[model samples]
Target: MADLTMARLHEAMTVLYAISLVFYFIDYLNKDAKAHRIAFWLVSIVWVMQSVFLGLYITETHRFPILSLFEGIYFYAWLLVTISILLHCLYRVDLPVFFLNVIGFIFISIHTFAPNQIAQSPVGDSLISELLIIHITFAILSYVAFSLSFVFSTLYLILYNVLKKKKWTKQWTRLPSLDQAQKGMSSALLTGIPFLLISLILGLQWGFASFDHFSIFDAKIIGSFISLLIYCLILFGYRKGKLHTTMYAWTQVYAFLIIIINFFLGSRLSSFHFWN
Candidate 1:
């Protein structure tokens, strides 16, 4: 019965994600305001179910899920979507937070139905080691938060470009004003930098603790550092008043791409990081 319940709960999470994706798509087309409102409500529902899914995963696994590229993409996607939604609500901007969620849904959807993928790792309700648990817990949360903020940076760039070319229309008109977008991105980066710093710090600490070697130079670390460098530049730009919205947004896309690279082909998936 417990097994069945977990399975059902997982299924519901997948369905909720599908609903979020659909709503995001409808919003993208600028089809109907009524539909957009409905989409908003659907996103709220998905958020709740998404939380439940995460709660169950943590309770069952007793650790963070930063294992594979698939998990990274999806986890980061959730973070990005939530931040986008928050910014959307706070600024009443037309940023496409929903579109990113749709993208994340498609990325994670494959695994949702793949029991083989989900079943490969089985923990028999035993307590996970304290060190491993702590390592994974802090790492995944910080990384996920940074990932979401990264997405916001990307959106800011897009809106900036449209504004740069002086191409405003009903399609893109709903985006935040340039001033708001600039400030919003700065705020996000400000928040993300601290998380990135923490992840890096914790990662270094883990390396020294586990391998007795300092400076692992693993793919994940290198990628993360590169992403960090870019983010630092973005911050510098902001301070120097050189960070325009489009550039900052592009920085986000670039960072996310690097994250994808690190997740799939980089060291973050190594046994050091663990990816099946």
Candidate 2:
């Protein structure tokens, strides 16, 4: 019951943090003080919640939460929130605070989703150690970025079709302009690419280091690389004028489909990608 309660609390905190990120993004683009103020207060609430959790953890465990990988991740995230809050209040550095909270949110997500049970055997523990956890976190985060890209691209396509058809509605009017959608998609792809590349590198390294029977030709491995390639090519095509607005948006939609397939079917087909 306690664990379940804690889990719910953590989920709530994450949701608030995500909403804060949306406001921060708005402030980043528009320099809206109201949005910034909302983000600051939201983050401040998150920090207080995290601090309470940390206190409870220390009270129960009688030690600082740095001894285990899970505890270490939580503490790291807490430190990031702390720093972001200090920066927001003291230095007024909006960009750094936004980014710091992003990283913090990622780490908190890692801690939240990771399984709570420790393995009984040494091999079992080793298989699910820090390296594996970090690899999975990076991969998931990359997918998150790609999913954002897909959303914006999908929006772009919808807007293009509506405009092309000369159809105007109140709902359509609320949507950002085509150029803004294009920029959002491009920005998400730019963020996703580096994250996906790094994740692949780290995942491969973890696999090779941990598994004696690891195969580079694993389905997940192949699929991940293919997804990365397709995204990169789409970006290149757009930048080089080989792909126009509609075409580029279409490619992103198709590429995102590939990602969905790879994430699910490829996981089932892979030999040792056990974190499914």
- Model-by-model lDDT, in order? 0.62, 0.78
lDDT of 2 at 229: 98
Over 6-75, each residue of candidate 2 has an lDDT whose tens digit, in order, gives 9999999999999999998887777688988999899999999999999998798564544344665577
Best by TM-score: 1
**RMSD, model 2, all Cα superposed?**
7.6
In candidate 1, which residue ranges exceed 4 Å CA deviation?
1-12, 61-91, 113-138, 141-150, 164-166, 212-215, 241-245, 268-271
Models 1 onward score TM values of 0.75, 0.60
Q: Which residue pairs clash within candidate 2?
A: none
What is candidate 1's lDDT per residue for 153-227, written digit by digit as tens? 656667777878888777776665666655655666677677667767765765676565555666667777787
Q: Pairing residues by index, what is the TM-score of model 2? A: 0.60
